[model samples]
Target: MGNGAKAQQRRERGGKDAGKGGKSQLKVNEASKSIVCGTCRQSFMTTARAPALTAHAEKHSKALADCFPDFKV
Candidate 1:
């Protein structure tokens, strides 16, 4: 294939990968850090991988709320 064709192919593949649920997977490069939700006082871990972090945060919220009814934020 010509160089231009190869480049186009690579771009297309990259776009497809990005279109997938790339947000859910945890990226290895970013450090894990705590995130404080503005809506709640509870803190949760966040990472470069927003999808995984969001999932973890939601789980934390549910567990905390279930364990303590009075839990706020």
Candidate 2:
């Protein structure tokens, strides 16, 4: 794929470790770092991988936006 296509793909999957300045706010150390549910504003523990944080997202919605492979922008 060309650079444009790769960039679009990265933007579509802008989660942890995807690339620089991703949509995910997940972090490993600080408790202050966490991701919030867009619908409810609920807070979830920050994690680099989706499995660690996918449960709560799954509870409210099927798609794990900014947490898993699901894209949220």
Candidate 3:
């Protein structure tokens, strides 16, 4: 199967895009020690690195506030 099929399956199972691309959607998983992209369910192993995480967030058209509202970016 292709990636599209897998994505469809994830949608059917209500797994992917579960965060709706809003606040708290992008957060660090302490246990896993990774930054998870709630919009696409993609994970980054850089371990909550701000610059890397910010770069990824840009792909979702999200501003710094979406990732961290209290942050002074």
Candidate 4:
């Protein structure tokens, strides 16, 4: 019930090191309105009227599946 115990609980539930020491997993470029994938390092631009981010994520998922056929995402 102390500070150490509370920190330990947070760590167990993936709160303390979830972002690898308070760093973001995604790198966003505000000027270009685009995001670069943290894992594969792929970059893409966004549109005004469509959900381009979702499509880009799907590409990452597909690439992951192709690279690791036996692994479950």
Top-TM-score candidate index: 3
Local lDDT at 47 for model 1: 34
List the candidates ranked by TM-score, beginning with the highest: 3, 2, 4, 1
* lDDT, ranked from best to worst: 3, 2, 1, 4
Model 4 alpha-carbon drift over 4 Å, by segment: 1-34, 46-50, 62-73
* TM-score, one value per model: 0.22, 0.35, 0.39, 0.27
lDDT of each model, Cα atoms only?
0.52, 0.59, 0.64, 0.52
Clashing pairs in 2: none
**Residue range 1-73, candidate 4, lDDT tens digits:** 8999999888889865676665553554445544455556654444322244445557667553343333232
- The lDDT leader among the candidates is 3
Error in Å for residue 50 of model 1: 36
**Is 1 or 4 the stronger prediction by lDDT?**
1
lDDT of 1 by residue, 20-57 (tens): 66455354323353555444555444432445445645
lDDT of 3 by residue, 14-50 (tens): 9666867666523544446444566776655644557
In angstroms, the error of model 3 at 20 is 45
lDDT of 3: 0.64
- Candidate 3 at 31: error in angstroms? 9.7
Clashes of 4: 0
Which model is ahead, 1 or 2, in terms of lDDT? 2
